[model samples]
Structure formats: structure tokens, C-alpha cells
Target: MLHRSGSGGPAVVFLPGAGLVGLDYLNMHNRVAELTTTVLYDRAGTGWSEAAVLPRTAAEVTDELLELLRAADVPGPYLLVGHSLGAAYARHLAQRFPGEVAGLLLLDPFHEDLHARVPQEVRDRLKELESQERPSPTEEQLRFGRSQMAPLFASWPETVRDQLIEHHLRVAWRAGLRESENVYDEVAEELRRAPALPDLPLIVITALGRDATQDQLWSERVLREIHCTTRALHADLASSVPRGEQRILDDAGHGFLHEDRPDAVLQAIADLLHRVEQ
Candidate 1:
């Protein structure tokens, strides 16, 4: 595991979205680390981390994370900032190891019951992914995908953009595809089995782009419905916890929530840290 620590108060650990290494979150990490110690590490099979046995469930991944932290001698009562699928892991960690967690900030998270909440078409696509063997992306495919995502990384420095694209194409894509195919259902089931999270500072940041219609073609209907469903689920999740708060960032997509709205993200962290200290 590759670990980078920044100096300060309580540690803030970042859990990257599926397939991304800790470096993928450099923009947000740099911002958070300025105020507090920050920890970012690659999961097994991603970035510099060596591959581990596959088909790992959320509970298993959580155990591995705890072991990594302990082995590294990183003291906890940590503030966890999890993006996308990582949010599921953060929630599981908090549920199972409440004392170790100080706060939770979930960025555009996937709901444990997302499969049930989304439309049939969306569910069908996810099932298709689950049934098929993970496809290796060709150079042409990678280039095309990167081109489509160009606008998102336009704000990042040239070097960071180049490095992110290289990492995504060469290392993250295949591992992410395997994880999605092998353990998605198991992870969802694991989250379903988790008890409600303990009372703590919680922030659920949801991206609700005003022009989401422009982003879809064949999946327009499914996408619109999914957005509504996602918002509702997050609201319910926030309400379930004592100190939970939900914030919607209009015109923000999943990537832009941290990259574009760093201020909002930092504010949420600041607020959570203040509450924890109090």
C-alpha cells in the first residue's frame, strides 16, 4: 500500500471511488491536508498496491483497511471522506467500528439498495455487466473514453491530467472492471446487513446537475429516474443518522463535486471537524 501523510490534527482518510488510486483525489486531498493530517493509500490491485485475492466484499475490504491503518501505526478516530463506491466502504467501517470513526463525508455515494431503486433498464445494464466477463479496454477505447472526459480534467494541471489518464488506462480500468463484476452484489448485500451507523457528524454530498438531460441519449429516461431516486435515498440516509446533513450541488457531476466545488467540500470537512472537537 502507498501511504502519504500530511501533518496536522486528527487524520482525515480518503477513500477513492472504484478503480481510482488515492492520487485520483489529489485536488481534494491537498485542500484537506492543509488543515489536518491526511492519509491516502491505494487498495490492493490499484496503483502501487499489489493484487490480493479477488471477489472481496465490503466487509472484507473494510477489514483490510483497518489492518492497513493499524500496521501503519496511523491512529484513528478518523474523519473518512469517501467518494462513490468508497462511500459504501466508509459507511460499513463506521457501522462496524464506530469508535474508530470521527465523521463521514460521502460524495455522490451509491445507495446499498440502489439496484432496487433504479429503473428496470438501469438494473438490466448492471446485470449485464455482472454476467459478462470483464472486457479489457483497448488503446483506442481508452483514448476515446479519455476524450469524452476531457472537460472534467481541463482544470487540472497538465502533468496531473496526463498522469491520471495513464493510470486510469494502464492500471485502474481492468481492476475496477473486475471488482465491479465480481463483488458488486456481495458488497451491496454486505451493506444491507450492516446496522444503522452510530451517531456522528455525517455529510452526504449529492451531485444534481441542472442539465443532466444533455448527458444522456439512450439512457435518458433511466438517468432522470435514477437521479430522483438517488436524491431521495441520500435524504433518507441523512435523516437516519443523528447529526447527518445532506447537501446538493447543482450543476455538479460526480467528478466535479470535489474538483469543481472544493470550497463546499472543505467547508463540510471543517464543519465536521469542529463538531467532532466539540
Candidate 2:
């Protein structure tokens, strides 16, 4: 895997959200590289990274991440930054490899319970991703596919919307299908039901203004993952770890790391890392 690393703080590892070609993290990675020892690696079979028979379980994903870290000489206690599906893997690794990870920065992540509780409307929106041909933007058949399926986001500015289009159009669609379908809910359950989380700093960014159908499910699942009843998942972290904080970014959607409020996103990461070292 190609590794992007440079900042001098503590090494931070980024896990991509089930898409090839991390055009999403490209800008943020370079920015963070200047702030800390940050490493953004394209997952196997994605971006310029070598392909692999991508693993199925969360444990397997964690192991592959370990391999990447070792290969890139990224020393641990790493601050793991994961978005969407990548959040599940990050939580799994944090729990499974307590000694190796120092903190977690989850950017509007998906929790498995949310999947089980998906309302028909949101579920319907996700269905097209499964049913249609996984077409490249080059193929005229999928030309308007992305624009037609805009329900995924509650709200977004033009730049963010454009990136979403690029992802649906330019990036490989098959990988997303594999991730959406094969990406199991069991991993979320494992993280949620853990008897006790390891003592590590955590910063969870939640996107608000969503309602009962999708919002309730996502909010509940994220809360359940932290095992908290508070407004933010970070509050729940204090119950498990010494230094933990949750910040709810009202405007940003699930993909906050690559969105317009990237400054806040990176600040959360820097805050988490600083929290641990102090």
C-alpha cells in the first residue's frame, strides 16, 4: 500500500471508507501530514495500493491495517482516524489491540445496529447501490445514477456534492458494493457489546439535524457503540477512558473528514492525540 506520512507529533493512521482512490482524503492527508506524523494508506485493492482478496471480517481488516503500519514503519500507539464503515474497523482494532492504539477519531461513523433498524425509505435509497450495474462514469448508463440517488445526505454544499458524484461516478463501484454488502453488522455489535472498552482517548464527531427514521437509528447505534445515553458519544467515552470527548458538528454529514468543515475534523483528531499524550 502507498503510505502518506510526514507530520511530527504522534503517528496517526487513516482508514478509508470502502472506496478505491482516496481522492476524499487526499487534501486532508496532506494537511494532517504537516500537523502530525500522519499516515493515510490506500487499502488493499484501492488507489495505488496493491490488490488483495479483501478480508471479510473486522478482525481480518484490523490485521491488514497492522501489516500496512508495519510496512510503512508507522510506530504505535496510533491515533486511528476512520470514517463511515472504516469506523467499525477502527473500534474493533482499538478494542482488539489495546496496546497498539492510543486514541480514536471517528468521523460520523456507521454503527451496525443502525443497519438493522434502517427505515424503509433510507433502505430504499441504499437499494439502488445494490440492484443496478456497477457502472463507471465513463459508461453513459450510470450518468445520472449519482444525482438521482441524493437522499443519502441530509444536506451538502456544492463542493461536497461534487465529490460524492466523483465517488459514485469516477471511483470503482464494485468495491462499494462489496463493502456495503459484505461489510457485516456483527463488527458493530462486537464494539457495542464489549464488556469494557480499553483505556484510550476517543473523539466522536456526530452530524445532527437528522430525524427519527435515519437519525434515530444512527444516533441510537452510535450511542450504543459508546454505551452512552448522552447527546454526544464523547461523553460516554469518559465512562470508559480517562480522557475522552465527543463533538457534534451540526452541519457536516457522515463524511465529515473530507467535507467543508475539515478544519474542525482535523482539530478533533489533534485534540484526541493531545489528550492522550498529556
Candidate 3:
């Protein structure tokens, strides 16, 4: 459920995106550990953690993380690295306990304002799909998914890579959808009502490349529109704080930015860490 490496204060903690386990970010975790203490952990219902009902509130998720850190005695003023849905929870934690956070590195994050930024037609389409019963991934679909993910894990240790690929193909693939089921509604409202984040170092990495999921869900025109809208959203987030900065990556997709461009993610974290120290 949790793993820690290295040793130092203002420890770096990785919050996995929906559907991803802590080990999914092992590549970056190992790299970060070389610099300072780093942690990788699964939320209550996801990854290797015990099962719980999905779609928990941001407060619930953040509180659970806090309790976990206390039990682990990892110390505070953490440098949080969060991707997608995990980024949302990181924002919640920073706002709720500003002093407990040192800085933040958000990757292709999901913001509360995203719903309003997206086109209405796309929203309607998403809602329609959500209303329908979700079908299980067939054998062909699983095989295709595995093939697509293989390259991302190629550099990882052989044993970890094999287990990760299998877990993702069989169960982790659905975790994101289940965890973010309330993202557009309750989750968004919760964030909107939350307190503002304190001044701190923040870096938002926006990945522009399209993945197979996007290709299957939208036309080329829509995908382009999405890219533009997402860039704008990330820019807005970066500008929200005085020290916040946005970095654009043309070569990586949303789900695998760390794998596709580990250098970029690591550099952002290093920059933020320096700023936090300052």
C-alpha cells in the first residue's frame, strides 16, 4: 500500500492518477529517491490497498492520505507530485493544510474549472456515455492495451514491469473511471468551495500528445480543440499563484507523461524543490 525510499525532510510523495498504482510511478520514484525522501502509496480502494467504495470525496481521500503519513511517520511539509485525479486531491490537501505542504508538481491535472472550459457537446457526449452500462474489456481489448503499455514500462525493472502490465490490463484500467465518476459534479463543487492554496512553488506540466483513448473517443478536430483548451486551462492554473509556472510537453500524452518524458517531470520537481528551499 505504501513504499518509501531515501531519507530527508519535505519528502516527495507521489499520488497516482486514477486507475494507476503506486508502482506505476516506480521509475520516477526511484529517481526522486536519489534526491530526497519519496513515497508511493495507493488510496483506500485502488492499487494494492484494501477495497473500498469508489468515488470518494476529495476531503475523504486527502484525510486518508494524512492519516497514512502519520502512521508511517514520514513527517510533513511534503513536496507532492500528483497526476490527473491525484492532482485534484493534492490541491485539496494544500488548501486545507497549507503549512503541511512545501510545493506541488501537477501533471496534466484535472481542475474544477475544466467542466466549464470544455465544449457543451463534448460534455453531453461524456454524460451519455456515463449513463450507459460499462462493458468489461474483452480479450482483444486487453491484449491491445497490454501492447500499448509495454513500451512505457520497458525501462522499468523486469519483475515490476511485468506485474504492472498485468495489473493494469486486468483491473487497474477501470480504476480511474470508477474513482473519478463524480469528478464533474460533486468533486468539482467541493474544490470550488474549498479555501485557496497558500503561496508556494507550483509547476503544472501539460502534455499535448494524443493517446489511443483520445483517438477512440473524439474526432481529430475535437482532439485539437481539447489540446488547445487543456493548454489554456493549465496556463490559467499556473498563473493563479505568483510562483506557479507552466511547462508544455509536445511529445507526451496525459496518462504517460512521466514515462514519456521523465526528464521534464524530474526537472520540474527539482526546480520546485529549490524554490521551496529558498
Candidate 4:
């Protein structure tokens, strides 16, 4: 794993969404660098970490994370921050290693089983991403052909948006789709057995809207594509996890962290940390 360490206090071990590399978490890393120490590492085969020779299960991913911590000598009482697809792995880690995890900050995480319930179009897009047709784009890099993805970055500022697009551009093609699927498969199981975690502080940052600022390019019609309502996923997670709290950022879409309002993301972290410390 390629680990990026920021000096300070309680370490924040960041995991990227879906197939993204550890570099995807640079925004959080830069901000948290001064507040507390943090470590950002690519999942095996994705970033700096070499590819694994065998298929991996959810249990194996969690175990690998534990091993990385030991290998890097990252002391515990850790604050885990995972985004989108990465949230499933975070939940597993907190459950499997209760003594090591201090808190969890889940940013618009995938609801797995809920994912299966998503609209056909969304699911189709996901499938396309998984296909061998082309490599997946980084959260940052949506270029000439990829400009269509620019709408997703609409909520983020200039600098944050640019780096993310560049990061997406730099990822290896094979690593994006193939490895992402493996993680998705593992996430499927995590959904089946969403373990009751420790009493450690847990904060879920939920995305809930198609903000008006979005251009005509964005469809306004209500999306009833997902079989399960977003509300249902929210309820299931709240019930299944221990000491969990949900905070919805009104009018923010799926890419809540990178959109027009980064301060909101920053504030969410600051607040979660404050609650944990208190």
C-alpha cells in the first residue's frame, strides 16, 4: 500500500470510494494534516500497493487493513474515514477490530444491498464502469470526452475539482474496473451481515438532493429507480450500527464531498472530531 502520512495526533486512516486510489482522499489529508495525523493508502493493486494474486473477500480486506496498520506501525484509537464504496470496508473494520477503531466518518457510503436496489440506469452506469470497454476515471479527471462527468464536480471549488479530475486521469486502467469489482463483491457481503459495531462514535454524512445550482444538463425529475428509498437505507444502517448518527446535507448530490461546497465537507469532519473528543 502507498501510505501518505500527515503529522499530528489521532490518525485518520482514509479509504477511497469504490476503486479509487488513496490519492483520492488528498482533500481530507491536506486539511487534517494540521489538525491530526493521518494515513492515506491505496488498496492493493489500486495505487502504490502491488496487486494481489488472488481474489479477496470482505473479511480479507479488513484483515489487510489491520495488517497495513501494523506494517506501518500506525497506533490505534484511530478515526476511520471512508467515502462511498469505502464505507462498507470501514464498517467491517470497526466491527472486526473494536479495540483499534476510535470513531467512524462515513461520507455518502454505498448501502450495498441498497445498491442492488438502485435504478436500472444507475446500475447500468455502474456496470459500464466495471466493463472492460475503458478504464474508470478518477474523482478528479473528467477531460474532453469525460466532460460529461463535469456535472458531478459542479459542487466543488476550482482547486479541489481540478486535482480530483487529474487524479482520476492518472489511475491505471486495469486497476480501476477489475479491482473495483472485487471490492464491490466484498461490499455485497458486508450488506448481508452489517455487524453491530462498538459503542465508538459514528457519524454518517448523507447526501440528499439535486441542488438548484445544477445546470439544465441535470435532470429534475424524481428518480424512483432504486427499489429501496434512500430513507430505508438510512433507517437500516441506523438500526444495525451501534452509536450511529446521521446528518443529511440538504440539496447535495452523491458526490457531496467534491461539489460546489467543500466547506460543508470540512465542517462535517471538524464537527465529527469535536463530538468524538467530547
Best by lDDT: 3
Alpha-carbon RMSD, each predicted model: 2.6, 6.2, 1.3, 5.1
Could you tell me every candidate's TM-score relative to the true structure?
A: 0.89, 0.74, 0.96, 0.75
Ranking by lDDT: 3, 1, 4, 2
User: Candidate 4: where are CA atoms >4 Å away?
Assistant: 1-5, 53-55, 119-132, 135-167, 170-174, 182-186, 209-228, 239-242, 256-260
Q: Candidate 3: which stretches are off by over 4 Å?
A: none
Identify the leading candidate in terms of TM-score: 3
Q: What's model 3's lDDT at 225? A: 85
lDDT of each: 0.80, 0.65, 0.89, 0.66
Tens-place lDDT digits, model 4, residues 1-278: 54556675467888776546676556667777767778888777566677674345667777888888887888877888887767777888887778888888887777666656666666676676556366455445445525754665554467656665555556543455454565546657764675667887777877766533223222444253331356568666765566677877665765445344457766766666676787
What is the descending TM-score order?
A: 3, 1, 4, 2
Candidate 1 ranges with C-alpha deviation above 4 Å = 132-135, 145-161, 182-184, 210-218
Total colliding residue pairs, candidate 2: 3
Supply candidate 4's per-residue lDDT for 257: 59
TM-score of 4: 0.75
Cα lDDT over the full model 2: 0.65
Q: Cα deviation of 209 in candidate 4 (Å)?
A: 4.1
